[model samples]
Target: MTANTSKSTEGAHEPGGFGALRRLHLSYAGEVQGVGFRWASKLTAERVGCTGWVRNEPDGTVTQELQGTPDQIATYFGAFSRVFAAHPIEYVIAEKSDISPIEDERLFTVRF
Candidate 1:
């Protein structure tokens, strides 16, 4: 995982700190690659002030883990869903895991 610095967005919710961080590891399937998904996700995470990582999986799914406050994290996921809906790129199958908090994360970026 890498650290990125981003300015908070207007009305953007953020977690307090490591203790407040909530984690969500998701598997995104269905035409998830080669469509700037990671880039778009970076923007999404930044908007909601989530700290974690999102990367492409070998199984053609976009994998991401996010840590943040409950509200902020949920807002992030909601925006993410809305983005996919508006973009309408192929299929946007996805599965999410439990939420957990993580420390030492600063910004969101596309992981290699």
Candidate 2:
């Protein structure tokens, strides 16, 4: 999919203000399926206070939509990267781009 870098003003008036809040649609390829990647993502999202959903695609990739403050998302990725470094599974961010944050999204989930 093509990347869209446009920013959204949907969350600008929220409690913590805007610009810092971000939502991203991401597709991960490689040894991502059946490798605990979704669980890791769920845990990381929780740890970083993010709200999103992750699922495995039929094409042997993983897709996730993550939402949080910029810092939180960074921290989530940093932690996930560390996990990857310790494991044999390799992954690439096949696609990632800004998306509109969902209002009242309170929890991260793993889709079956």
Global lDDT of each model? Answer: 0.69, 0.80
Local accuracy of candidate 2 as per-residue lDDT tens digits, 33-105: 8889999899989988999999999999899999988778879888877775666686778877777788789
Clashes in model 1: which pairs? 4-107, 21-101, 22-68, 23-100
| Cα RMSD for candidates in order | 9.5, 4.5
Give candidate 1's error at residue 87 in angstroms: 3.2
lDDT of 2 at 75: 90
Q: Tens-digit lDDT track for model 1 on 32-112? A: 789888887889989988878889988788888777777787688688767767567765435655543455778776888
The TM-score, computed over Cα atoms with residue i paired to residue i, of candidate 2 is 0.81
* Residue 52 of model 1, lDDT score: 81
- The reply for model 2, stretches above 4 Å from the true place, is 1-19
What is the C-alpha local distance difference test score of candidate 1?
0.69
Which residue window of length 10 is worst by lDDT in model 2?
1-10
- Which pairs, if any, clash in model 2? none
